[model samples]
Target: MGKLVTVGEAGEAVVLERLLAALAVPASVSGVEAPLLGPGDDAAVVVAPDARVVATTDLLVEGRDFRTDWSSGADVGAKAVAQNLADVAAMGAVPTGLLLTVGAPSDTPLAWLEDLGRGVAAACSVWSTSVIGGDLSGASELLVSITALGDLQGRAPVCRSGARPGDVLALAGSVGRSAAGLALLLAGGPELAEEVAPELLAAHRRPVPPVGAGPAAAAAGATAMLDVSDGLGVDGARLAAASRVHLDVDADWEDQHVLDLLVAARRLGGDDDPWGYGLVRSWVRGGGEDHALLATFPAGVAARGLPEPFVRIGEVLPVRSGWPAVTVNGDDEVVGGWDVYA
Candidate 1:
């Protein structure tokens, strides 16, 4: 949409080759050495040093996962990669390579595609990963799919079912900021205002998942691990169900970031008592897409070894009779987030 440069009459094969070069070359220049056998083959050959490769795949569909009007091609690309990489990290692995597939309409501009490639490369470079291979195709709308591969480095892959009673629940990275940014976009903040906070806008566009915290938690003997792709309440419930334990989140709500969101909501025409009625609190509880790492560690382990950015917010409890999987301040009704079919 910005400074359009169409694919022109170059045809699909030529354009596809150019696109792949644009994506792979920069990553290579940035010291992202590809595998022994890289792209342009029937398939990419990746080495799994520890003999166990953590692999995850995610798809971002236009109008479903993102909107063209609100997000640039680069934003879409980065978001797609972040979500996939976070999944790999959730298994306590270091990401090594990524395979991307992009489908777009014929009329989609070449510049947009180039920007997307740059975004993909930049995202991979953040974690020292390489863009190994991919495919391009024509479609009715934009669709980006990414598959990430990681190395466990001889450590046991952490699973969500390992949490036990008396474990401490901790969060690495932030929550509710993306949802607050989305609320701003929905309230006409981006279009109506000449200036918007970069943090709020970036939160929705390119979420920076806590990549380092996953392995750190694992090394610190974390029992259970998962990324907060969905809202805290929903994902916490999932962890509870998987571990067969009750997660009790009892963090104080007076943090400065939460207060800032409350002020922003009021300015955006939300009720004055956003916190009182659970509107702001709900975002912290049920907001999704942040991709933060939520992990459980044995009591003394977390206190003594869990590193920076990992803050204790809750504790694990034994599964009591007739109790829900997750509860906040002893309340069980706070469960809602992104549901594709809902």
Candidate 2:
């Protein structure tokens, strides 16, 4: 199990001060410019270089979004930052600052908060971003909420609906990894899968999204794009609906993704059953949370070739006459995803 010290030991009064230290960034090391001003006022002041802010926020609560047994405070911290900043990146913008607010029970460990802050600081460091300010409070369960601000630097924000019929659908990173990892954890967990798939645990605990690829696609002339936080079938359909086009995904069981899923099934000690393939298919098509970047490039940009980290996965087609907007191998494939209420 992960190590931690209780908040009771730190005392509620001094918690903020200590946590702030953990959240502080090393601008020199990270290459992220220091904020105009950090914590210590009614509000923090941050610059919007493009004079426009691309803002997005997300909420993660215990039990619903994560389980304490599965992840540590640091993992949740890094994860919270990732999900929000990834939205900023998908807009083809660079994150400049973040506003974080967390609520936790009194029994919650002080180390958890410190680790959470450190996690946020660490992930932000990669994108040259920093957390300027946030709030702390008492609650029955741990709750993490963050709002990320980004700079467009004079480029048009890539929307989810700009894809055209002739555009090429592409993916910057593989999806279903988190799903595969989650499956392994359910089948046996870290102890059982120690030798078989340790990487699966890492994938589930901390997801490193292709934040840089969004900008690269923007530079390469991406027409539409989004982070595959929801499974591809669900998210891809969203993109298709918004762009008024149809998305046909490539489906070849011999594909690398399928092979990877097969590996996970073997770890579960499952025999070669059709049900195993079905589970893998479900994960590949619907298990979102890997934070892969999906985009559509116009034929013009397609001719010159797409950007690095993005490989052609499908093609934009005319919208369905009256049904699903996303398909596989030119036919209908059931769409699934991690909808909060679904």
Name the candidate that leads on TM-score: 2
TM-score per prediction, in order, is 0.92, 0.94
Query: In terms of lDDT, which candidate is strongest?
Result: 2
lDDT of each: 0.81, 0.83
lDDT of 1 by residue, 281-311 (tens): 7777888888999999999897686766788
Error of 2 at 177 (Å): 0.3
**TM-score quality measure for candidate 1:** 0.92
Task: Show the lowest summed lDDT stretch of 10 residues, model 2.
Answer: 1-10
| Residue pairs in candidate 1 whose N, alpha carbon or C atoms collide under 3 angstroms | none
Give every collision pair in model 2. none
Off by over 4 Å in 2: 1-5, 269-275
